[model samples]
Target: MTSFRLHKAAALVVVIIALAIGSTAPVTARDSSSTSKHVAKRIALMTSQKAAMDMLTGMAAGRSTFDRSQARAARKQLIRSTGSIRKHFRKPHLDPRSNAQPLIWHAWKDFKARAGTAEAAAKDLNTGSLSGLRRTLPGLMQSCLSCHETYRSTPNSFTTH
Candidate 1:
């Protein structure tokens, strides 16, 4: 495979692993009950975004056939989910179930900006063709990774039940 293809493959694997870990990881009792609802909402939002991303990534990685309508639907879902990220994280609610770093609250503006970038990338995604998806999906994935690397705590860093 070409270097670019290898890079894309690596990114796809990272995203898949993240989603897997996030989905199955149990919640601990490290946080207060008051913030649990907020954290749950945040997790649900992220889960939805991950579901959409999984579909696009599958098509991009040639693991699944690309249907233009399905790709477009995923693109729309991403656009909506990314657009809501700032609102979802506006509160500094930390829960044991959350992988969010405290730095997110401290670096609020930067986090919002990163979310905006992801939203823009989602909106720019071209689902009209598989080629378009292959070309543009990396930008969206990169935007997500850029924010996640800085704002999300690894599952291993926190204790889980």
Candidate 2:
């Protein structure tokens, strides 16, 4: 098969993997009640960011076709989501369901700086072409992973669903 077809097949496989990894459903109302409004909003914001990242990463990794419009949209979503990180976590709201670590509140300045780094990375992402995405997406992903490593609590199974 052609490169495009291979990428398409890979994209399908990625989607299947995402579903198998429990990305198919949002937290139910019962779960929502376990967390505060601030915590819930923060979780939602992170979820949105994750979705956009998944799309962009799939393209950058040659697992999906590079559609400029879709890439741009994902980039935009990331920018917005990163911009909101501070607002969402402004309060030290915590709940059993929240994955945010206490260190995030203790090291507030560092957390904000990391959020700023993520925002900058989102703004820096270039969706102009596949090459641009391959070049810039890793930085953005790294920023996210850096913050998560320091601030996010380890999930029991890496699934929110």
Candidate 3:
């Protein structure tokens, strides 16, 4: 398979693994401290997402050169960060964490589906074509909205869901 195909397949696998990790295990860490636990994970996610957005934006502004090595590095880091968030959702808790509503767990299937879309779009971004990344980034952003509408954060409040 070409790199494009490999990226796409890898993304799909990541999504599948994320769902399985989040859906199968019960969250065993539900407590008043749950908020902090979630905060840490959210912070990690926000940091990683920020980096990913920055790199992709480089493509848009003609700042990032589209090299296969850079794409692979960025994608690998994203996978690690996202996978961390996904595992946080699992881990045995009676209730969901801060920045995470019970709604996400309740609608696990739909959530996973939308996340997969974002992943696939990211794969398209890594397909070794700057033009392709430019065209596809918006679609991935929309896919992200699929979840954000339901899960919004209030800065450090960690109380908004």
For 30-137, candidate 3 gives per-residue lDDT tens digits of: 222544444444544644565676776676668867765665677665555444445545442332333455576777777666566666665655446777667766
lDDT of 2 at 84: 81
Error of 3 at 79 (Å): 3.6
Model 3 pairs in collision: 26-92, 27-92, 27-93, 28-92, 28-93
Candidate 3 lDDT for residue 159: 20
What are the TM-scores, per candidate, against the unseen true structure?
A: 0.76, 0.76, 0.57
- CA lDDT for candidate 2: 0.75
C-alpha lDDT values of all predictions: 0.76, 0.75, 0.53
Candidate 1 per-residue C-alpha lDDT over 58-150 given as tens digits, one digit per residue, 9 for 90 to 100: 999999999999999889878987988998899998754568999999999999999999999999999998899999999998898788778
Q: What lDDT score is found at residue 111 in candidate 3?
A: 63
TM-score of 3: 0.57
Candidate whose lDDT is highest: 1
lDDT of 2 at 152: 80
Q: What is the lDDT of candidate 3?
A: 0.53
Enumerate residue pairs that collide in model 2.
none
Tens digit per residue, CA lDDT, model 2, 1-161: 23354345434433443454463343422343424445655665766677788899899998999999999988888898798889878888876456789988899999999999999999999999999999999899889888878888763322444
